[model samples]
Target: MRKLANRPGGPKGAAIIRRGWGKVLGGLTLSPLMAVLLTPPAAAQSADISQKVKAECAACHTETGNSIALPFPKLAGLAPDYLAKQLRDFVSGARKNEIMFPIASQLSRADITALADYFSRQKRTPAMVTKPQLLAAGEIVFHQGNKENGVPACAGCHTRNGAGAPRFPMLAAQNPDYVVQQLQNFRSGARTNDFGKLMRTTVSRLTDDEIQAVAQYIASVPPPAGR
Candidate 1:
């Protein structure tokens, strides 16, 4: 047997190798093999929802609810309750969005719930802060509001790290431009979804510069680890 093994070129050598491989392969079960083939890659697992639903959302928010589009807000990592509320508002015309109103109006309550849950579980990519020069001014605005202008500190509602509370949004890693746009909308009364105009009143006293600075600062705040 030793001599036969040593002589690898022997006629039996080929059969021996095939037999060994067969024995090893025999140990693998069909379920495990199917799972290996069927499972999506780790990074892509976020799109576990139906392809139709994912495609619909992907057009604007992307499958993971993280989009680089400056106009769209990051939906990933936000509380499911908040997302669900926003969707319902859009559907009911409580939140006036020219683009989203039609699409959201068509969705059922279950669809809204599923999308909210799906996006909430997705990990959000970090936002890139433009105009780093404004960071200091932005930080001041975020942490300590301008008393002279009657602007309240953002940290009081958004938390020190901007992680936000139940109704408050998770502002960390949000696009600065989008943040600025929303503030402007609030101040201008173009967007009035905030309960009792809380955002409208809060931003009413903020100057254009202050709004920009605060947005820039918010972009600098990192999202929670692994989220």
Candidate 2:
């Protein structure tokens, strides 16, 4: 056999090693650049969704879904699944709202999903509290139910801070008027979309004053961080 170390620092061996290292280094240098080039930006992906929200939803909910108006509920920080379900309910006549029904009817399922995702990620602004007394009264109801009236603690389902679960909605910082209206709706059978009539049952025994107090309390509470 030929002496292995004798020719041009073993030309074929050195050349092969150099080529292999060059390929490895090239790949390492280019990998991140290639990823950046190939991947679409997050903002770019949501651009169309943002436009759609601006055109259709911003009029009432605002661009960030943090509407301050009593007539419109804030959509920010709500669970995406809940938002999507509400949109679908409006479309299907399960939730009756003349304004929302028409708008929701125009949207495709994909549009609803996109809107839900967009709004759910937005930060929620705190709702202004105008009634400290009502808020105090509501806080009691929220944290501890009226056992005499057979009412369960709102926090039991909505969490102590009102962060809410996947199915239950976040009630903290919700518009007081909107919350009251929903409770009335649930009590009167005007809105029946709640799973297993939970809202209806919960609100059934609550007096008008209790409802108002709870709504005021919910409106006054601050949302969880990033919610």
- Highest-scoring model, TM-score: 2
Count clashing residue pairs in model 1.
0
Residue pairs clashing, model 2: none
Across 45-163, the per-residue lDDT of candidate 2 in tens digits comes to 47768888889999999999999788689999999999999999999999999999989999988888989998999999999776678977898899998999999999999999999
Q: Residue pairs in steric clash, candidate 1?
A: none
* Candidate 2 Cα errors over 4 Å, as ranges: 1-45
**Residue 147 lDDT (model 2):** 95
What digit string (tens of lDDT, one per residue) describes model 1 on residues 1-227? 76876465766787777788789768976585576565676423334345645657888778777778877888889999999999999888777888888888877886788788888888988888889999999999899999998888999888998888889888988888889999998999888889677889889999999999999999889887666
- Residue 153 lDDT in candidate 1: 92
